[model samples]
Target: MPDAYFLPDYRTIRYCLMKHILHGFTLIEMAVVLVILAFLLGSLLMPMSEQMKQQKIRNTQQRLAELKETLIGFAIDKGRLPCPASTTNGLETAGCGDNTEGYFPWRTLSLNIRQDAWGHPF
Candidate 1:
């Protein structure tokens, strides 16, 4: 009797088991938290996306204006508009001022932006 181990009684063991089993949040609570996090992230990100779109629009507009000024400068110097580049490639596909009508001579004028932000030729 002096060497016997002191085991916990059944009532205490049951109480400990129940406490461990009920310790954490339920599955529904976790789901609700995840839903709330998703809503917060979505709301935070939406305005940023719109601002990015607006910035792109502003950039395209600036590029277009610069392109106009460059063309005017070229006309003043050369006495005629530069030839249109090929639609397929960005650079001037033919000789300069050969058929300078349809497209902007971006390559001939040393301009880098061959197309607008929307991927259409300037």
Candidate 2:
């Protein structure tokens, strides 16, 4: 070699390093990333639907509590409790049990609880 120092400059070294590091992702790498994202997202969202169902159950219980309060208020206002309304037509046709335990009368109460969570009738 000629009498000369051959040290690489900082910019040359950086460019060479970046040439190796800044390449596009390979097909396998892309697929792996997609799979990892899907797994993470699925893991996050899997319990969300179950949580939503639990929220619905909580809401139904709240509605039931409100209905109870309304019924008690009505009983307090009137001398006797109102009869249970028909599930189909909402007409006051069903009588309460001997102790006044029965289905909630939606129509008589003028409440909007035709169906509970999971599409079941109240």
Candidate 3:
């Protein structure tokens, strides 16, 4: 048989492959990216947290007002003030502690029981 075609140089191919293998992020670079992302996310979440707090405050105010109206209606219908509840669960319908006050839940109407976000009583 006659001489076959000469093969291309393998060294160049190996060098290019090595370069490609080295061209990627190191562990340190990946860690830095993660840290930056965490910082960005934390900063963004702060404002959202504040907004959520304000929303909660407004909701609490509205709910308290509604509770006040309900208590007033209950009193008018039954001819007595709504009795104070032992807790702030807001679902007490059978009076609190004892049956002395005609089954009125008043814990929702107390100014001292309710508190603002700053931990002060409403």
Candidate 4:
């Protein structure tokens, strides 16, 4: 066996141990970090989706208010309320006595709106 004098000292042993430990993060550590990042991103996205839905609702409400005002203005101008529009086209019908429910007369009103915020007919 070699003499004790030829063996590695305690300082050399400690240096080698620290070098290996400081090489890089382990696979398990990387996976844990990725999971934490995913959780953070998911939390942020949920509220953003909810905010988008709220904005759509607000837009729909504003459009409905505008339509009500426009209808009132039309009644004052023509001395009578406009007739409901036909299903095939958005034009006002000649007679409204038979129809209780129908499309809005956007064409006759000279309005460009054809649908609501959710892509449904006004």
Candidate 5:
């Protein structure tokens, strides 16, 4: 071994240890990373949510079209527009049955309306 007097530099060793200790992430660094992640996630999800909404709208419109076609067909079949029934019994009533309830044709067309993706009156 070299002379015992030639000891390693403790100051440099302490400096290197301190540097390593201070090299960890700071609060600001973590906050910045979180902010970036949030932005990326928001950008990714926004288009997906919008696409889902558009799909729902398109599905609703398609269902409405089909309902209109069924209504027209029913009219042609009976030579008149469908009328609402007195009750769930599917009997014709004084006025048109609740078209909104899908009972205009004695609930026969309810299946068509229910097929819509959103399953709303529209």
Candidate 6:
């Protein structure tokens, strides 16, 4: 008197316990919806990472004001101001007199990026 093929009656154990309690989330509600979607994707990526670090510090202050107006238009077309580079081949340096610092000749101002905006140099 208890063998409906094997024995699962009472309306199939109350419809398999109401289809496993409505069949859904419950590992603490999917870990509280994955911790509220990782706290809403970390508050929307923290102001887009501080607006990409203030657009890389305003693109390194507009590339140091276009390299100080290309070194004042190469000292008004080469009347003076060149020499600086030569940390072993960035050019320039025929004579910065008593070595007035160095680096930034950008190949004697023909320009082509020596580095900046985080890479350093320049």
Using TM-score as the measure, name the better of candidate 1 and candidate 4: 4
**Per-candidate TM vs. native?**
0.65, 0.60, 0.47, 0.73, 0.63, 0.43
Greater-TM-score candidate between 2 and 6: 2
Write candidate 5's Cα lDDT for 38-102 as tens digits: 99999999999999999988987887788788878888887977665445555445554435243
Query: Higher TM-score: candidate 1 or 6?
Result: 1
**Candidate 3: worst-modelled 10 consecutive residues by lDDT:** 102-111
lDDT order of candidates, best first?
A: 4, 6, 1, 2, 5, 3
- For candidate 3, the per-residue lDDT at 109 reads 44
Q: Candidate 5: what lDDT?
A: 0.68
- In candidate 4, which residue ranges exceed 4 Å CA deviation? 1-25
Better of 4 and 5 by TM-score: 4
* TM match of model 6 to true structure: 0.43
Q: C-alpha displacement of 73 in model 5, angstroms?
A: 0.7
Decide which is better by lDDT, 5 or 6.
6
Better of 1 and 4 by lDDT: 4
Instruction: Give RMSD (Å) of candidate 4 vs. truth.
Output: 3.4
Task: Point out the worst 10-residue segment of candidate 1 by lDDT.
Answer: 90-99
Q: Which lDDT tens digits does candidate 6 get at residues 20-114?
A: 87665366688889999999999999999999889978888888888899989888987778878769357887757864887888876777777
Per-residue lDDT of candidate 3, residues 2-116 (tens digit): 3434665688899888777666546658888999999999999999999999987897787578667876777788797655544554334554454453322445444333555
Q: What is the lDDT of residue 113 in candidate 2?
A: 75
Determine the C-alpha RMSD for candidate 2 after optimal superposition of all C-alphas.
Answer: 6.6
TM-score of model number 3: 0.47
Tens digits of per-residue lDDT, candidate 1, 1-122, equal 54455655788889988777766546658888999999999999999999988998998999999988998998899997667766635455556555355666677898887777778877
Overall lDDT per candidate, in order of appearance: 0.78, 0.74, 0.63, 0.85, 0.68, 0.80
- Tens-digit lDDT track for model 2 on 1-122? 44345755789889887777656446558888999999999998989988998999898898788878888888899867788654544545555665544456777777777777777666
Q: Quote the lDDT for 87 in model 5.
A: 51
